[model samples]
Target chain A: MNPPSGNAGAPLLEFDRVTVRFTDVVALEDVSFRIRPGETRILMGAAGSGKTVLLKTAMGLDRAASGRVVLMGEDITRRPETELFDLRSKVGMLFQESALFDSMTIAQNVAYPLLNQKAIKMEREKMEPAVRDSLRFVELEQTMERYPSELSGGMRRRVAIARAVVTKPPLLLYDSPTAGLDPITAHTIMALIIKERDVDNTTAVVVTYRYQDGNLVANFRYNPNSGRLDPVGSQGTNTIFMVLRDGRLAFEGAQAELEASSDPYIRKFVKRPERDAA
Target chain B: MLDVLKGPVQAVQGFFELTGRAIRNVIAKPLYLNDIFLQMDSIGVGSIPIVLLTGTFTGGIMALQLGRELQQYGQTDQTGTAVSIILVRELGPVLTAVMMAGRNSSGIASELGSMKVTEQIDAMRALGTDPVKKLVTPRMLATNIMLPCLTVIDDFIGMVGGWVIGMIVYNLQSLRYWTTTWQALGWSDVVQGLLKPFVFSFVISLVGCYFGLNTTGGTQGVGRSTTQAVVVAAVSIFVIDLFLGKIFVSGQRGL
Candidate 1:
């Protein structure tokens, strides 16, 4: 498939039959997919179905036991950790738990990627403003001095988002960004994600259990002029929906194809009450 | 049958791997000097009160018990010598490490375990910072540097406790007590005392970090790692102390 940018260059991420194992347990098995630049891929699965593992494998945080993973045109399947740092700096990831350093304040957390990423070389004076700008992007500029424990879960997730995007990488991965949030809060989180996608035009892979979240990503665009999410229609967006079951990809297709899938496992993810009729 | 041994074998292998990585990170670029100082402040300065209290009482107890034994041999004035020898050569290092194993080992385990379960360590790596270099190496270096300092303070305070007991309880002269305590410690005894805590520091930090980084499950897993870190570190201290003491003894005997 062509990327949203219509750049027929190399894909941003490609997995060729990737498998990951922990001891005797297979976390991800023979999972193959290609994520092009400016495309958002939404991955859905039940708990322990390797959604998180797949994201980690893509980032080179977890090693692939077999097959190959080419990220940003580099074959990272067998790349040593030291060599992967520069490549990883170009790809931002939000862990499932927010994972902000408990010891650091919100500003410090946001500045972490900028200061630590070897590929990023901002002047020291530019750091605070960049941190402030990032936090302001998340609408949490006032919470600079506050530790993560001081913030609510949604706010902490936003701070994590700020940290992830501070470097302004071309690729982003969000692991269960809206998990454990109330409906209103979940919508807010999803709106922020859509805003990140529209403003930067960066490729994203969102791991989520809620089909509603995926539906939003696939069906809406952030209208920068109106500062709101506008319906873009599924055809207007370059998004793919993937469903994993028991360490294997059960389904991978467009929203219409997913909605028309006959597989029970794939149907289970799309069976949300409010969106059932759609 | 081999399956039964796999768990322990893998654990030992993992521990060594982590130890090697941590050691290498000490000399690697991007040394986390700030983290090392922070750990020193926490692990070193935070340990003073317990070390002081334990040292003082241990010396007082030794004097009270060993003073009578010395009196029976017409060597009541020798209380300082005996206390100094035991405290400098054995008790001070082992006891300080045991106490630190109980305190810092559990502390490091719980802190790192919490980070692991919450995926903060993974986040650190994801952010282009190696967790072992940022987390484990600092603790290892700080513990290695500070355990010996704490041992020195413990030995000095223990001798002071012995002197107080000798003067007040045994009615011995202050000058005699000072002289005997001063003369009792040989170079080998000092070397043995300093070396043991140095070795125990590695056990304390590495075992705690090992269990912590490997923690799974959730909060329950953190608690389990904390308990296991303390237990393994404390046990390893005693076992290592026995071997070290045997080596020192064999050397003294020219065996």
Candidate 2:
């Protein structure tokens, strides 16, 4: 069944009445949403609002206690972990804290998915260029030999981005991609997210607290020729804004609808365009 | 009453579940040989010096103590029989296992706890690698292999320590000491020594992995898991040693 929120053509990710529980705690309660091919979703929520849980649930990292999650047209809910690997390789995820392997060099971190993802079988000779190209996409090719601890926080996130997209999967999930960065660095990370979207035509779901990060994603398009993010007019991006409140989806619509939201909790996240200009 | 019993019961269930999966992964496909070797270096090779030092001191102290007791009966020359039996049948396996419980169990818990808290383990799952296959099984296998090897070395080095004491303090004949030490061990004692370590390896590695994977609350939680892993594994070693020793002693007595 098609979700009312998404555009036409089969959904890339669809959560049908999914509820995730941890013993007595209701992490996600009957949450359902849909994202069609090439659509971008900006998920905003307060701390402990089940945002990360939703992302993990979508990835099949955490199984749904009830209902079903369909990813790329496959029913993933209750699928055994062994079977999930092949399905997970078709998606890329950037964790909240970067989650780079501390023991591995940046190159190894980026190369991990390529080497380990059972579906992506590239020879050793071809692997290095893919690793280098992935790092180059983040503009950090020179730091390949360095460990995650040696890099700055923003650099590590970028390296994480490089790792996430190295496989060039059809869908990318960024959990708080700009969560802990300075304003300028957050912008850079958002710009990279947009660039990946525009370049690969990849579907994305970005979880963030910063309304500006969502705004940038909604209103900006990356220009490959200029190597910069260009401000786009109304129809340039197919961005859906979602607000999660206490384990339930409170809002799901376009930027205008999100800004027009009257809910106080939702308003706390919407930073209206007047402030965006200031 | 059931509420009070629930947490520990679930913990035991979860631990066995983890142990079952880890062992099954031993024969499962996609074996991570590199990870296994890396863990071998970390758990096995890295443990050598501490094992050697502790073994020497423990053996030396046992010889000193046993030699004094034998001197009471004018049987100082029989120090080899007492020392070798105690070291092989009890001290070697128990002491080495306790040391590993302290060194490797806490190390595994803290390392994996940090990974867990940082979401690296989740990331590992997302990247199409089973964290248990990649992390826990390798550690389990490495500990299983290494603990026995370390125990043997401890047993041999301990005997050397006993001989050292015989030569210096007791002024006992080297040939007689060596002969008694060699003949002191029966096949049962050897099996018991090796068997205890193999069993203890499972306790040490699985306890560490259990506490680590279950760690919550972030950094402080890592510390708690580390402490719990060490304590649980060490206490378990002694507890299991008592039972195993009882069974072996019973068998020898034809009970």
Candidate 3:
């Protein structure tokens, strides 16, 4: 059965009536959202509004109290953990903190997914080119042998992006991918995210609190043939923006719809400073 | 009061759950051999000097103290018997176990707690890596292999310390001291020494992993887990020692 919020065709992810609680607090309650194939859904919420939890829940990193998580035509809400590896291999998640294993080098971290899978486990030398290519994808090829601790905040996040997309997973879930970086770094990270979604046709679930970040990904289109991000007219309507507030989906629509929203909370959230507006 | 009972019960439940997962992951496919070897180096080879130092001082002191009693009765030759017997049957294993609980257990807890705080552990789960297999199992296996090895090394070093005392300080006959030391130790003593460390390894590593995985808050939580690991393992070592001692003693008597 198609869910209430599900888009046309089989959705890559569906959080049907999902609720998550931590003791007395409710992080997410009866939250349902569907991400269809080739669609980018930006999950944005204020700090502590549970955007990260929603992103993690979709990846099965966080448990839901009572809900059905249907993924790619299968109900996996109660799927056994052993079976989840196969589920996870199809989805790549970038954490808020990058979460690169500090014990490993950039190359080693990027190669982690390749090394974990049994069928794909090849010799170290054989894995090098793919690992290097992933690093190059994020424009950090020179930092391959360096540890995560050695890199700046932005560089580590880029490495994390490289690691996330190295396997070329069909679904990419990013939690604040560009949250803490400077403008250039944030833009670079967003460009890579767009490239992955647009060039590779990867379905994406991006979590961010900044409206500009959401607008940035929706504004640009990656022309695979041209190998560059070209400004799209009307942002192509392929990207769906969402605002989560108080454990529920408060807003869901296109960029224009979100910008035009009259809801007071959304107004305050979407309102830009005088410099940006001017 | 309800919360009090609930906390311990929940902790014990989580502890067993972690233990069961470690057991399953140990025999499962795609074993993390590199991690296991790395942990072996950290827990076993890295612990050599400390274990040897602890053993030597402990054995030397025991010799000095017992030498006084034996000298009073002109039974100085028998100091070797007493020292060897104590080191083999109790001091070597117990001492090494305590040291490991302090060193390896706290290290594991702090490392894992920090990871939990930083979301690296969750990151691993999201990336399709079971932290238990990639992280816990290797440490468990490493501790299991290394603790016994550490106990053996401790016992040997302790015996050397006793020998140094008997030959030089006490001015006892080398041949007599060596003979009594060997004669005082039976196969049972050796097995007993080795046995307790196996039990202690499981206690220390599992407790550390347990405290680590359950950590909350931030840096403070990591520190709590580290302290909790050491305290729990130290207390547990004694409790486990008591029970294992009872069983071994009765079994030896039966034999």
Q: Pick the candidate with the highest TM-score.
A: 2
Against the true structure, what is every candidate's RMSD?
2.2, 1.7, 2.5
Once fitted onto the true fold, the runs of candidate 2 whose alpha carbons sit more than 4 angstroms away are A1-6, A274-278
Global lDDT scores for all candidate models: 0.92, 0.92, 0.86
Cα shift from native, residue B148, model 1 (Å): 0.6
Arrange candidates by lDDT, highest first: which order?
2, 1, 3
How well does each candidate superpose onto the true structure, as a TM-score?
A: 0.97, 0.98, 0.95
lDDT of 2 by residue, B1-255 (tens): 999999999999999999999999999988988988899999999999998998888888888988999999999999988889999999999999999999999999999999999999999999989999999999999999999999999998998888898889999898999899999889999999999999999999999999999999899999999999999999999999999999999999994
lDDT of 3 at A195: 83
Candidate 1 residue-wise lDDT, B25-73, digit = tens: 9899899999999999999999999999999999999998999899999
Q: What is the lDDT of residue B118 in candidate 2?
A: 97
Each candidate's clash count: 0, 0, 0
Select the stronger candidate by DockQ from 1 and 2: 2
User: Which of the CAPRI classes, incorrect, acceptable, medium or high, describes model 3?
Assistant: medium
lDDT of 1 at A121: 72
In terms of lDDT, the poorest run of 10 residues in model 2 chain A is: A1-10
Query: What CAPRI class is candidate 1?
Result: high
lDDT (10s digit) by residue, model 2, range A157-273: 999999999999999999999987998899889999999999999999999999988888888899989898777875758988889999999988888888887889999998865
Q: How close is candidate 3 to the true structure, as a TM-score?
A: 0.95
DockQ of each: 0.87, 0.95, 0.72
